[model samples]
Target: MTEKTIFPTRLKNNDYKFTVWAPKARSVRLLAESPKLEITMNKEEFGYWSLIVSGIDAGTRYRYELDGNNSFPDPASLSQPDGVHEASEVIDIHDFEWTDDEWVNIPLDRMIQYELHTGTFSAEGTFEGVIARLDYLKNLGVNTIELLPVAQFSGFRNWGYDGVYPFAVHDGYGGAKELMKLVNTCHQKGIAVILDVVYNHFGPEGNYVSNFGDYFSGKYSTPWGEPLNFDDTNSDEVKNYFLQNALMWCRDFHIDGLRLDAVHAIYDFSAEHIMKQLAGKLDELSQQTEKPYYLIAESNLNDVRYISSHSKGGYGLNGQWSDDFHHAIHALATNETRGYYEDFGTPEQLSKAIKQAFVFDGLYSKYRKKTYGNSTKNNSGEQFVIFSQNHDQVGNRKHGERLISLSSFEMAKLVAGCMFVSPNVPMLFMGEEYGERNPFYYFVSHLDEELNRLVNEGRKEEFKTFFDDKGEAVNPASEEAFERSKLSWGIQKNPEYQSMYNYYKKLIELRKNHPVLQVPDKDKLTITENGKGFTLHRWQGDRQILAFMNFDQNDTELEVPFNQSGNMDKILDSTSTNWNGKGETSPQKIIAGETIKVAKEAILIYSN
Candidate 1:
């Protein structure tokens, strides 16, 4: 199951064992630093050039010289201490002292995911800086921290998907050493670390993989440009190249899981798909490490085949980002009717998303004007990670509007309540728990001026057809745009913020303490939509729970449903004065057929 550890030019017994794949090159050489050493590499079969040189060890900075004149950073670089354009550093993966010896598997079912962008999550924008907030995150009931890409990208500020070197951790995020420390600290605090990785395409800047060999295909087209050469000639090595990167994250960094970005955009047409190969390798890694390692895909396909088991002729992944759920609630709460939101915005869609995993399961998508999604045959609800808001949902907008700015405070609580009580793994964006209102604009730094201008234009042009002013918004290439996306940590301490934060904390506690909320069984859940709103029903054996949300502006009475009629006890009411809302006492106990007063945009949770 484990892949062969290749490239990396390891140092053993005072000699540097150099190895690289450069098929397109006529000649290749190693230019090492600290002693100014150069060795003529032997071009072996399959275009692999390698040579064992003496007097080079850990911390030995080096670069691959192509055609005896042009030097580029190693494609399998361990560290890029001097930034992406500079020489790559030879690192000893075993040198870092880890403290997670007793650390085992973090069960997927017990996870409360918190998605964060490293640069924006903390002021320092480094892996070490994340440690300071571990206590805060641990107390916030987030068992797992799903970081956006930390790989070395073009600039100090980016979403991380633009990373060119898959193995090199970004220097801004404390490099490889600081990343190790972050993972170690997370494990020490009983938290799992899930790393986000990009493989669909490399960033436009500092990408030199094509100089050595064919890493991209001229045939396949993607939104970003040429797709990865997964099925082209010499693609076996290419697949191994990315597979080695995935293994490096889990095996070298001790990361618990990986979230693959935009798999739908990863065009691979082969009998043995690249994703299936990667998933199979992960199975080997999970068993070898004896940890419950996980693989999540951010797929827009909405096909259950992504998470289906290998035996079922599909890529066996852990879960995928269920945008259907986010869209359902977002359209319901905000009432936006542009772009993809134009097809949603209905109570029935929200109900379908809750009861079934995907709202568009095999149905015709009006937005696409075609059939969308496949039935999730036997896939559990927990296989989908549902969230009220995420970096993509909020940051990709015209002005990067968050739910707090788009919806009422009561509606925010209602959406958050659904996320907590739903029978699915829930995730929270970095500042969503405290209702931070800063925008998460998409920004990047490209050294190429012409390319940078094109990137800005493309971003604006894509939004023009569906949005009015979305195309004429702020330029993402500017420095001020990146600064504006940074989280305003001070505002989180306000009384208004604390009230919602405390509600989130208690809701997480409710999920952790109760078994019914943790188990995501679609068959055990039910949803009913009325003229006023909808009531979701959840049950386990003798215990039962019902969550009601009133969307009507005027207060209305909702009928509760239960097969075995009994008095339902109130657990949490968002209308209470404690939440700085209208103080209305929803009866502590109500019979199955009895009605309960539901305030405007009010959220009520009852257990029996």
Candidate 2:
């Protein structure tokens, strides 16, 4: 039988087949909390323990007792109603009535992802809260929303990366049923859902997976926690455990895609890599359902093997995040050359990132003190997902300052222009479209007081290189930090924020309507670095677009790159009065060989 049929706590007609892999246990017993029952499970091959219990319906709480001594919650639990340390609740995943049979996933290349945290995205801070804003996102022209991890964590407030139960949905977010409703409603609103999943390392608090079996590897170490045992002895069942988790979100909850978090940290040295196996499994699932399902990775190695084809000795993932693109734009916009930003902050670097996919393609870095990253010139732009700001970029800071709060409003518009005009898929952080000024701090509500203190100290130590002052950082364990991170929806009605929202809408409209902008072929794109700025010219046969980006603080004259007799019409100007800019500095019509005065901190788009 396949993993789907063999693994997971399955239920059929009031009968439950409870299965768990505990290689080190001498004996295992099931302790159903409600309706009170105790049964001994038979040990099978491959260290799996199983038993069949009748008359137990959905919502029954249970735990596993090992060696008639210690009891722990199910590792593959579907619901944790009270918390991670409490008993696991049995759920019928197929019980929900879904109406999205005809809804197909949008292609990865055409996605405009808007990432949000479930705890801070709305006032309700539940799955239902996100469903209430689906129409708002659709009207803003975002086709997809990438949610931070929603797996069961330690407490009610968290970023979701500290998830302990891979199969269980966070009880604070309304559990598995509410997540299904969110996905179904999003599809009905013509939006797709991409979930962020952490497979590299488990969180510190309430992690009991290592108690029953060899779930973690002492041979390797990660900054977050103990690395998963992927290449060690008895690794087959370990791989199956995570594989079934990925398929459960797709088969049970109907998620469109998953963004693998920090895959570079997932240590595996087997002959067949874990990522390759995951890609193959997802491909089979997509074929079986006749619906497209995508797997995107987050890696800073700048290696193409993560997104390349299997025939070429690659993992064959659909897409990966481009940190170099974000770094180049961010360093130029903010101009704070601290930490990793030391390697960026130049027009040439930005130009190279826009033309090629990676800025540090086998180049020596002053920060790392060695050469880093392989060239991505051969890869298509569709294989990359670019963003100006994300959860890590904002939350990792000492003060958690967003781009809007860290820079001027004009600079924010300028960066958005650069992102939308590029060939890669663009993503927006939540509240970015409306110029939201909230600080998305790293927060968690761990029950252990010692663990909370350690987290706060670790956060401060991590940012010592970024900030000159040694003052205390915002407390990640405080309730105030989590409350301040919530998005202020009422502020969008203000004049300044309303204008920023409209500007973003216009940029999305242009990207969708223009043929040249829609194409992701970087070969047809040319970027020329000028003084303090650059010129980007992309063409698809007769359809062409020329963008002038000025990052300097003063006006600069730049020569048009078109032919002597060619004429182009201006489509967008970030410095125009309509977008709450100083005024229009660039002309509406452009002739070849003519010099135009581009406003400082502005972006001008022209088409022919």
Query: Which one is best on TM-score?
Result: 2
Q: In model 2, which runs have C-alpha deviations exceeding 4 angstroms? A: 1-12, 555-565
Which runs in model 1 stand beyond 4 Å of their true positions? 1-4, 9-14, 470-472, 553-564
What local lDDT does model 1 show for residue 230?
90
The 0-to-1 C-alpha lDDT of every candidate, in the order given, reads: 0.84, 0.88
* Candidate 1, backbone clash total: 0
> How would you encode candidate 2's per-residue C-alpha lDDT over 116-222 as one tens digit per residue?
99999999999999999888889889999999999999978899999999888898989999999999999988899999999998888879988878888888998
> Clashes per prediction?
0, 0
The window of 10 residues in a row where model 2 has the poorest summed lDDT is 1-10
Task: For candidate 2, give the lDDT of residue 602.
Answer: 90
Error in Å for residue 124 of model 2:
0.9
User: Residue 61 in model 2: shift from native, Å?
Assistant: 0.5
